[model samples]
Target: MGDEAGTANQGAPNAGVSKSVSVRELVNRLKLEVIVGEEALDRPIRRSKVHRPGLEFAGYYDFFPIEHVQVLGKKEITYLHKLTHQERDERIGNVVKYHPPCFVVTWNQDGLEYLTAHCRKEGIPLLRTPQTTTEFMMLADGYLMKQLAPEIQVHGVCVTVAGTGILLRGRSGIGKSETALALIRRGHRLVADDAVVLKKVNPQVLLGTHNGTTREFLALRSVGLMNVVRVYGRGAFQDETRIVLDIELVPWKENELYNDLQLEPQTSEYMGVRVPCIQIPLQPGRDVAALIEAAAHNWYLQTQGYSAADEFMRRLQQQ
Candidate 1:
């Protein structure tokens, strides 16, 4: 399972903190074989970057980042093969002394006995992958970025309406899933229901997706569980999309005494990125689905520097 350390404490609506993943999780997710030091699987890989260790293995340890996962490719392994047994032992011993999170041998490890022995003795994890150097590095780096990325899980439904990712938040039994199902029937795509995992892959971009068995499924009140793909077809489900809008639904209240005119803009901050938020009060015959669709469309226009409300206000002021 993915790390839920960041999922437990979801602070005020949209605030989120950074996340971390253990070496054991990476090993299982990436399908890397544990060649030695299985006991050190609990090591925490603090850094997202993977080191090639070409220079380190070549007897140059200056500026080597031992906290990162080290990958040994064909070139690095070939270099070790060219060295005498004693030289190779000394070189590997030096690297093992640094105690990197783990060493991943890509493609094969036909001549890594010295390195493996030193790693096992020092209680350092040694992993191997059948993928080529480039392939393994690419996969590992991509997976690491996702696992190490700052994430926040929200109690909401994320759906794509008119190409805009909108997170619908509300209290329990507030029709969040119902609204999402309506949008999906209208040809929009559902990213997640019940629990939406938002990851800050980029500094300003937040991507929405679902974790575990919740993906591609929605739970309705009358209906127990329904698969979005089966009910609305395959086009109704999306793996992930950039979250751009946050819509909070509230039960209509009498004498709410709030601003009738939305003169002030509201935003929700998640993992340091701000997203535009709109609160819609739920009432009988409000056509919530259409309202959400319109909100998303308006937000999309706003991103392009166009605002209908602002334009209308400007014309009224001139009058």
Candidate 2:
């Protein structure tokens, strides 16, 4: 499950910064044939949205999103076909001079000699796909959203426990992987081990996925690297999940105070999203796996507006 050649290097500048993808990567991922401008495949695509160049090709360039991947569908191409050669040349020529990131022709429309020629001369990559305009745009936009989404890689073990995504963080050899392995044995799903890539999908959502090379695999200190999917079937591993809780495993401090009564809420921020956080002290003979499972269940209950601590307080007040 190694990551594709270029995806490993696709990281944001800062923790919450936006990221860009290359035209070459999109070409490879989208299976688009490069009709022209092969040399310009290295151009950066900063925008995730694709634009249909109908307005721009009609000589209205104001507020044009030149950074977007220009898409030419049937209507746009047919409109171009309606124009005389000289008229088409002037309008599309103006477009080429702007040097938009790239152009994509969908539905395998022909009569793109001028478009291809202009793109090649201006060093703008022009690609063609057999998919319809709508399909191609949707696929490209979806991929771009994932690629350009704000992401941060953390050193932790992510697993799906009782339908809630929990990220376990702690010092080296603090039993993160071992705990995850135990949870997997209990019918939970392992998301990522060692390195988990967390992406902010929405303002309140943080999605976690495995590093490409480690997808569907976990490294146990006792057994080295093992494929969870191969050993436990597909149900044992998941590619990604929306992280909802953070569990920190720490060595037990003899004199340290612990939160026995969960009256107050604790949270930790990742990729600009705040997630419920709990600390479980690691000590000999402690069942950390069961504790984490309990934490997940507790968090799920909190989400549903039911907290045992709150209920207990209400009963005491009534008394």
Candidate 3:
């Protein structure tokens, strides 16, 4: 699942995982469980598994809180045995406190067979794999992560442009296209226009970009949709949107303290979900396009825990 209330990059931890799940689902992801040692079911797993797994294998932990881990291969046996008996006792204690992850692991077939025997011998279900440890962990992680990751409608956008999710929004007449055109002129590629699609992919990730139907170019008020590639060449266009700061367009209002938008940006409830929103009011003669681009890049700084508005407000309070 995901953390219910956090930015897209922060990745909320709860999407759909409840207090419990069906064994069938768990087995589908974890594949097999190998239970070793007679005391395996009695307490936590005594040995610590490898310190770090391969990147490809990190997805297998369905956020189970890592209650216990089994180190079965002979390579790790000496290191595991090096632990004091009391340390072993504490490690295994996590098993008693948490079930399911209590006892399971094997090195070679000998270890596997031993573990399998206890699981079957004691009526505990065990899973076996012909693949090596590396392959096994990958399969396990892939399955578990899929089971735990949130479901979102993705618009396929490159999100490496700073951290904030930047959304450009405005009415058809409001120069959303002209602003985007000018932004691209200023070097920020267009995300999506005409029809911008969005989706929440991971726990904290909200992906927005141009849909396949409209990825090629943007339509402007002064002109029709121009081919960015034709003008700026390649790398000037994209097919996705990462919605961090929402750049809004409306005729200028002198009464409105436009930039008072938000410094320590907070979530705005959209539909039933909450998302970070920044409102940028647009007006004529203000170079709306350049401002939107600047707003996006500035949002990056703010999201990095640097709040210009907050610091200014604090100083004003002191004065």
Best by TM-score: 2
Better of 1 and 2 by lDDT: 2
Write down the worst ten-residue block by lDDT for model 2. Answer: 1-10
lDDT of 1 by residue, 1-319 (tens): 0112122224344334445677799889989898888889998887788999889877887799988899999899988999998998888888889888899999966767787789889999899999899998888888887777777777889999988988888788999999998898899999999988888877888888997679899999988999988877899999988988888888888878756655477777777677777778898998999999888888878779998878889999999
Q: How should the candidates be ordered by TM-score, best one leading?
A: 2, 1, 3
Candidate 2 lDDT over 62-178, as tens digits, reads 988988999999998999999999999998998888887899999988889989888888999999999999899999998997788778887889999998998888778999999
The local distance difference test score of each candidate is 0.83, 0.85, 0.47
**RMSD, one per candidate, in order:** 5.8, 6.0, 11.0
Give per-model TM-scores. 0.73, 0.80, 0.48
Candidate 3 lDDT tens digits, 1-319: 0222223333233345442233344444455443343333333222222222111122234444443233234343333355565654443333223334423243333434333533444444443445566765555444444333333332222221333456544444766566566666666676666655555444455566554677667676556767787898776776554566544455667886745444554564322355655445665467665555566677667668987777888999999
Cα misplacement distance, residue 292 of candidate 3 (Å):
2.3
**Model 2 reaches what TM-score against the true structure?**
0.80
Q: Distance from true position, residue 248, model 3, in Å? A: 2.0
Residue 100's lDDT in candidate 2:
79
* Candidate 1 worst ten-residue window by lDDT: 1-10
